[model samples]
Target: MDFKVQLLQRKSKIDKVIGEVFKDKNGLQKTVIEAMEYSIKAGGKRLRPVLLLEVCNILDGDIDYAMPFALAMEMIHTYSLIHDDLPAMDNDDYRRGKLTNHKVYGEGIAILAGDGLLNLAFETMLDSINNDPKLCNRGIKAMQIISKASGINGMIGGQVVDLEWEGKKIDIETLDFIHKHKTSALIEASINAGAILGGAEENQYLELQNYGRCIGLAFQIVDDILDEIGDEEKLGKKVGSDKSNEKSTYPSLYGIEKSKEIVSGLIENSLKSLEIFKEKAEFLRSLAKYLEVRDH
Candidate 1:
């Protein structure tokens, strides 16, 4: 199948899983539930979950067994976006061309919504494990990886540094550190969780980790490039916010051309790391290439 066709098929499966997880319309705390659904349903690429499923497929693992982890990864990712767009954080009013959670719902409600999603993510993961005892260890490992990636040493820690350094002159090292943790950490978790649950070997696991890290960094670099050059209509958000906030980015540290070069290098490195998996990794390798040049 063509890559786009395969991507669409995978997206369909992911959407089905998401629907299954959130299907119950009748529940307690209807408002909170509604808010949670609103955030989750707001369309994004669903890239993390897609990565989870793809990695599992590559490892010859069961997609059915991976669905729960895939859903959980998306929940975690959405929660982070909710928090990242808070008034105290990025303070943005738009995401994916829709009102940010805080902008549509009050900030307090948005915060609660993000909190609710995070707690629910854990609940969802546990439920998945309950359904299959054999996967408990794998699930546990997935949980650990996600927790570490989303916690202080990972996303949140990077956010703190990003917030602290706003409008301040920062070196390239610090800028890389901020993005690697804030953005790349969760991305790494996404791919790594899939690899682990897919029963990747120790050497393969390490290669995926390296691949994830490189793509994670490249993802942010492309994001920075888009902020500078992409159309607001295509991006679903305002362009130049990074400059408006004086945030340190690759484009800020290096010129746009140099940043593009850097992103290309990272993408090359990411593809190189997949040599161990050969044909099994073709989709992921293509994904890295697509991410580097995607319009949104």
Candidate 2:
């Protein structure tokens, strides 16, 4: 199948799983649930979870065993977006071409919605372990990796540094730190978690770690490039928000052409790390190239 068709197929499966889990619960807080539903249901590329499933499939693991992890990753990602758009953070009023969660649901409800989703994600992940006792160890390890990636040492820490350093004219070292922690950490976690669940050997796991690290960095570079020259209609969000927010971006540090070069180099390095997998990693290699030229 073509790459776009494959992506859409994976995304469709993820969406169905997320939607089934996000259904209205009886006697729950309606408004918070509504906000969570809205935010999660918002259109996204579904890159993180799709990548997770692809890695699992590549390693010969059952995709069904990876679905809960995929669902949890998406929830964690959506929660981060909701919080990122709150009054104190990026303070954006629109996401994916619609009112942001905080805008339509109010800040308090939106915060609660984010919290709710975060907690529910863990719940779903932990519950998934019971289905097959034999896979419990891998499930536990995957959950740990996911949690740490989104926790204080990872995404939250990066967000903290980003806010502190915004408009500070930081050096490349600091800029790279922000990108690695804020963006790359979760992507790395997604790939590693899938590998662990799929029972990757120690050497293969190391190679995937390297591959994921490169892709994560390259992914942010692509985002920076898109911010400079992407169509709003295609992105489904305002362009140049990074500039307005005074966020340090690759394009800001290195001009557009240089940024593109950096992304290409990163993709090349990522592919090299995957050479050990040979034909098994074709999807991952294609994904890296796709990121280099993605419009949105």
Q: To one decimal, what is the Cα RMSD in angstroms of model 2 from the true structure?
A: 1.2
The parts of candidate 2 lying over 4 Å away from their true place are none
**Which residues of candidate 1, in runs, are more than 4 Å off?**
none
lDDT of 2 by residue, 65-165 (tens): 88999888989999999999898987889988989998898999999999998998898888889888889999999999999999988998888998888
Q: Global lDDT of each model?
A: 0.88, 0.89
Worst 10 residues of 1 by lDDT: 25-34
lDDT, candidate 2, equals: 0.89
lDDT of model number 1: 0.88
TM-score for candidate 1, residues paired by index: 0.97
Separately for all candidates shown, the number of backbone clashes (residues 3 or more apart, or on different chains) is 0, 0
